[model samples]
Target: MSYEQAIAALNDQWSQGDMDSDEYALERERLDYERGEMMSAQDAPEVAA
Candidate 1:
């Protein structure tokens, strides 16, 4: 699934009390970091082969 969908699922889990605040925050941060990396890679200039 995409990062957006994964984040939505995480939010649902947190809302349903399946995850504690600490764990949810950690996971959310990790997801956000990964999303940022993916976005950065996509936006980077391509190198000449």
Candidate 2:
């Protein structure tokens, strides 16, 4: 999912308290890592197929 979508989901999860602080932190970190990976992939130069 996109970062915005992930953030929205995280907000909802946070509001629901479905996750503890540690869980929330880990999930957020995972989302951020995913987002960064996506960004890096997007920034990479594409090779001709």
Candidate 3:
């Protein structure tokens, strides 16, 4: 699944109290970092061989 979808599911879990605040915050931070990395990679210019 996409990062956006995963994050949304995580939000649902947190909202439902299936996860604690610490765990939710850690997971959300990781997901956000990963999403940022993916987007940065996509936006980077290609290098010539």
Give lDDT per model, in order. 0.90, 0.84, 0.88
- What is candidate 3's CA lDDT for residue 27? 98
**lDDT winner:** 1
- Candidate 1, position 30, lDDT: 97
Q: Residue-wise lDDT of candidate 2 within 1-49, one digit each (tens)? A: 7789988999899999888999899989999998877777778747322
Could you give candidate 1's per-residue lDDT for residues 1-49 as a string of tens digits?
A: 8998999999999999998999999999999999987887788747322
Off-target runs (Cα >4 Å) in candidate 2 are 45-49
Candidate 3 local lDDT, 1-49, one digit each (tens):
8997998999999999999999999999999999877777778747322
Task: Give the runs in model 3 whose Cα sits over 4 Å from its true position.
Answer: 45-49
Q: What is the alpha-carbon lDDT of model 2 when measured against the actual structure? A: 0.84
Clashes of 3: 0
Q: How do these models rank on TM-score, best leading?
A: 1, 3, 2
Which candidate leads the pack in TM-score? 1
Q: Candidate 1's error at 37, in angstroms?
A: 0.6
